[model samples]
Target: MSDTFFAYLVTLAYGDKETPTLAQVVFLSENEAEDTRTVARALLQNAKQTAPEKTRFDWSTLKVHGSQSLSDDELMGLVAAAAQGQVGVGRVSTLKLS
Candidate 1:
């Protein structure tokens, strides 16, 4: 049987604002996803140092929009889109299967 993977859709806010300005999708085990979220939160503490001044990403706004199980093919497409830099600043976990 193939291993099951969970996809987490995360959005990062640049400042103390409530709205998110950036989005990223991460695929991993449930536990790993939780751990990654923690790390993301820690990174937010240094957002100013990490992101350029022109890019307004409020680290305090980081959040997990949602999560779901992804089939192998769907996961592959996400990987492909990430490789091609086509994800942009939007949701990627919901891409339809072709």
Candidate 2:
């Protein structure tokens, strides 16, 4: 059987701080996650390495159905908390794991 999965593309903005702020969130199916992740990471890398600005861009890929999955709402809430510096990456809690 082919298992289905949900993918979230979370954009972040870092401005003179160690913690990045949430910029946007986009939902996609598993099929599109890899391609989108590749492009997004490439762009993020380019911006970090080539851009001469103080602001930095990055992204987090959340796959909602695996060992590292989180509920949609929970993930969003944690993202907001992270923006406020209340949490850090890999600190988002989850209730289900498979």
**TM-score for candidate 1, residues paired by index:** 0.28
User: What digit string (tens of lDDT, one per residue) describes model 2 on residues 17-90?
Assistant: 56554344333333433443343443343333543232222224444333355567766565454445443222
lDDT of 1 by residue, 2-69 (tens): 34434444442322235533434432232333443443433333232452232222322233334344
Model 1 CA deviation exceeding 4 Å by range: 1-9, 12-65, 89-98
Name the 10 consecutive residues with the lowest summed lDDT in model 2. Answer: 88-97
User: What C-alpha lDDT, on a 0 to 100 scale, does residue 53 get in candidate 1?
Assistant: 33
For model 2 the TM-score comes to 0.26
What Cα-based lDDT does every candidate model obtain? 0.36, 0.39
